[model samples]
Target: MPSMIEVRAPLEIKVDPQGGWELAFWVLDSFNYATPFRAMLIEIAEALAQHPIRSVSLPDYIVDEDFVEGTLLFNGSSLRVYYEHALSYLTLANDDRGVLTIVAQRVQSRIALI
Candidate 1:
């Protein structure tokens, strides 16, 4: 399994003037080292933000009407984004199982470990 770390800060969902959506990222003090990773996340976020809530396509790993959880692969990294949707905003979703946190991990190649 890859080592995962939650991105607790620097994530925000923004609303466009035309009622579309976008994901904004602030300066993450500790995450400055992962510029490429952040870029990939931004690309994914933009894809999801450009569309309407109900119309957005999410991974079918967890089937729920309002909550979504799925892992995405970009090159050699794995990113997981999960959140609950309201009428106009995204909320941190939690349940008896646990909170679905946004996390990222690098998928290292086995041959590279040699």
Candidate 2:
């Protein structure tokens, strides 16, 4: 079975004016390292080919130690995605039943006229 962890539920995704993606409103600290959390990021990355998701970094097996700060599960250019495993800095996400909402915002800041 996959490991489970709590994040600030209601995984909200947004695109800024410059077309930058954003995720998470709370900090992800400390996790069940032994059991890797099935983050939706990976699935989203696979589903969305047009997105700029480079890769998803999951935990290694045989690693029974608790997840500490600096652990990563997502990778991309100009995007810093890290999982900090710390008990003192943790919050349980109660609403997001693991479904990530994708908000597609259309930005037409610069349109070339033919």
Candidate 3:
């Protein structure tokens, strides 16, 4: 699996009327466009629903990056990436209110489960 997936944080970008989201927010500095990102988020929700990822530790404190920074494996590979960018890019990028709500719930549930 390709390593690295972040579960948190926001991003910023400079906007020019000449360019749309590609200039502003920069999709968390990756190239996947918005539509594909929406679908990926949905897929994440569904995957967790079907077979939730069990936590490896309680309280889940990490001493370093190695602990928390790694691939999220499903079906023996990471999420079908768009443009080979990090999945976390979508997590951090601008999302619709409903989409954000869904992601929030998913993260909350995962935290509770852990």
Which predicted model would earn the best TM-score? 2
Query: What's the TM for model 1?
Result: 0.26
The pairs that clash in candidate 3 are: none
- Candidate order by TM-score, decreasing, is 2, 1, 3
List ranges where model 1 is wrong by over 4 Å.
1-58, 61-64, 87-114
Alpha-carbon lDDT, every model: 0.31, 0.32, 0.30
User: What digit string (tens of lDDT, one per residue) describes model 3 on residues 1-114?
Assistant: 211223334323323222222101113333322323333333454534534343111133333211122223333333221222433243221223333344444544332110
How many angstroms is residue 38 displaced in model 1 relative to the true structure, after the best TM-score fit?
A: 19
- Rank order by lDDT, top first? 2, 1, 3
Preferred candidate (lDDT higher): 2 or 3:
2
10 residues in a row with least lDDT, candidate 3: 17-26
TM-score of 2: 0.32
How well does model 2 score by local distance difference test? 0.32
Reference-based TM-score of each model? 0.26, 0.32, 0.24
Model 2: which residue pairs collide?
29-84, 29-86, 30-84, 30-85, 30-86, 68-85
Residue range 1-109, candidate 1, lDDT tens digits: 3222233344444443333333322322332333233233334444433222332335543232443444443323333334333321222222211112221111111
Where model 3 places Cα greater than 4 Å from the true spot, the runs are 1-43, 47-88, 91-96, 111-114
User: Which scores higher on lDDT, 1 or 3?
Assistant: 1
Clashes of 1: 0
